[model samples]
Target: MPQSIHFISIGGSAMHNLALALHQQGYTVTGSDETIYEPSRTRLEKQNLLPAQTGWFPEKIHTGLDAVIAGMHARKDNPELIKALELGLPIYSYPEFIYQLSRQKQRVVIAGSHGKTTIVAMILHVLKHYNREFDFWVGDPIEEFDTTVRLSSTAPLIIIEGDEYASSPIDSRPKFLAFQPHIALISGIAWDHINLYPTWDEYVDQFESLAEAMPKAGILIFDESDDMLDVIGQKERDDITKIPYLAHPSEIVKGETFLITKQGKRVSTKLFGQHNMKNIAGAITVCDRIGITEDMFYEAIPTFTGVSKRLEKIAESTDRTVFRDFAHSPAKVEATTEAVKQQYPDKKLLAVVELQSIDNTNKSFLDKYKETTDAADQVAIFIHPGSADSGEQITTSDIQKAFQKPSLHVFTDSAALQNYLLQERDASHIFLFMSSETFGGLDLSNLAPKLI
Candidate 1:
């Protein structure tokens, strides 16, 4: 019989995907979570992998269980976690298990403060077009793929969006540290997760460590557009092959974007923006290293719509449009807002961002937003005053002053902000909602239609 494996907190995107992957691998999988959200809850139920109910139970821990996978959401003192510790069963963090499975496969680890998901999705999309059999684990759900995570015993390659966040409670190392890929790509370095790495230098140190972990003969791909990455990538690393890429050659003709290839052929893409162009270049470099030719990369890119929530268009009318993006970091916020502004240069841009993540909630990180929202014709910064329950010391006024943009508005309440948008938004405007987390209780989708 296959071994029995249980997950302590299996409701998360990564956790749920891992649980499903294990089940597909012939393991008898059971999992418990305090709560499960849509898509995950539905997907789990479809596979008969949903827990009997929500909340952890110590009784679920047993000697018959061969392994336990604990999610980062679960604390070290969680009842299931404590029981698993007492039982002395083999426990693996989600990334640890991914590393174990990909040990024999040629792994490509994509790391960055932003754009990792898009780059990985681009690579996966091109590979799929070529009918190349490879497994991947991305952070967001790709429309073309059924699941965010996939694993196969016979697949020769594995692609992973290697995040720098801590793996689990017991394991404080960044999630990417476990992979130690044969070929690695660092998109760029930007200070983020102030709660984790309190200082910018400390945050950069993680990427340095990732660089050092590369095998002697492995390759390191980096973005030359980022001076910080340029400095780090150019440093004397004797063993690794370093390849640098800037924004791919492209042109905007009659408001349409097209790639200018080495052969002088112009190929158009469904996606837009300079950031996405850079993302495409990074993915193309990886594909070239993996034996895919330049022609194939360009040929496959036209069909790539993009990963969900990176820059998803929610609703559109004849004269107005609403876009929702998962952009919370200072760098991401700047890129996302700038992308929208550039796309609809003539349209009045109103960018609304929720300071939901731990870093954005911290007072020290507020200054990073300085001029980040300058591209927007009007900017609204929303913060759930109660988001930082730990009392790390931050105020909406501090964020307002930090941005230094005259048009910036700060909101502690979502209702007032919603009302402001409804009343102020006009037919010739583009509304962009940016956040890594959901707006306090507002559904951007439901609100999109009313805007029109």
Candidate 2:
């Protein structure tokens, strides 16, 4: 009989992808969730992995199953979890399961507070260009990639975007810890996940722990541009190979970004911004260690567009273009705004950012935003119309005090945000929206056409 696996609360972003990957591997996959959101819902249904019904059924757990995989969406008292526990069936969190499957392969993990996803996507993109067979588990959905998680028995390497966030409610370990890569890359280090990690030291400790976990022969790659990563890259790992990368030289001409190869060749690419130059350089270093040369990197990197929600173009016309990025952290917000402004220096740049995650939304962390979004000509912050201002959610006054910009605009309601965006639709301005959450759940595609 085929190996059977069951997932508890399987409709999450990562959970759904893992389910699809397992199904593709010929495992008998079954899953249940109380609430299944878009994209995940549609993707799961197409794979025939969607549960027969929406809610979890304890009866779905059986003694004959091979193992049970649980996601962060599943609570400790989830009926399926309780059933699995009662039956004494083996249970593993998503990260644990990923590790178990790729234990035999040369695991290459991209770990950082930011840019890890892009680095992972770029590595996968370049590896594909060279026809290198490797598997991956990225947090966000990268453009052109069907799923975030890919697994294969024949592949000799597994590239993972190993974030420092908790693996699951039951597992307090960081998801990256479970992977324990033989080769790892730290893109950049910053304080984030304020809710989970209360202090900057705690945040640093996670990445430091990741560094210390490497084997004697393990290779560690990090960006030397970041101050914190500079410390990480030079740590006393005498036996481990530590590679440091800076931004790959690039120039924007006639609104197109080009990578200046080592041989002085100007290679045009879809990617822009100084930060992205660093991302490309980091990816190239990773590829080089794995046998891909600098020439191979330039060839493959040109075709790389970017990952989803990271400077992803939503709507464009002859006059105007709108970009959406998943930039909730303070460091990312600053870099993303600077990048967009650098791309369209002569045009009027409007940047609207939202506070979604605990770190970005928490009032105590407001001081970190001081002058973070100053790069944009016009800066704005969107607070959900119906959200209460108490607790972790911040108010308009809170935002105004945080950034301390004289001309910054704060839209407390979706209507005002939408109306403002629509009013600027015809203006000669470049719009960049940075938020982990949608702008008051507004459909940006509908608004993009009316704007420049």
Candidate 1 Cα outliers beyond 4 Å, as residue runs: 387-396
RMSD per candidate (Å) reads 2.0, 1.9
Model 2 segments more than 4 A misplaced: 386-393, 425-428
Using all chains and alpha carbons, the TM-scores for the candidates as numbered come to 0.95, 0.95
**Model 1 global lDDT (CA atoms, 0 to 1):** 0.88
- Candidate 2 C-alpha lDDT tens digits along 1-54: 238999998899899999999999899999999989999898989988888899
**lDDT of each residue in 1-452, candidate 1, tens digit only:** 22798999999989999889888889899999999998899989999999988998999999999889999999999999999999898888888888888888999999998899999999999899989999999988889998899998899999999999999989988899888799999999988877788888989989988888888999999999899898888888878899999998888765467899998999988667788888988999999999898998988998888878888888988788888898988888999999888878888999999988777777667788899999999988888867662676567667778888898888878898888889877733889999877777887877899887
Model 1 steric clash pairs: none
The whole-model C-alpha lDDT of candidate 2 against the native structure comes to 0.86
Tell me how many residue pairs clash in candidate 2: 2
TM-score for candidate 2, please give it.
0.95
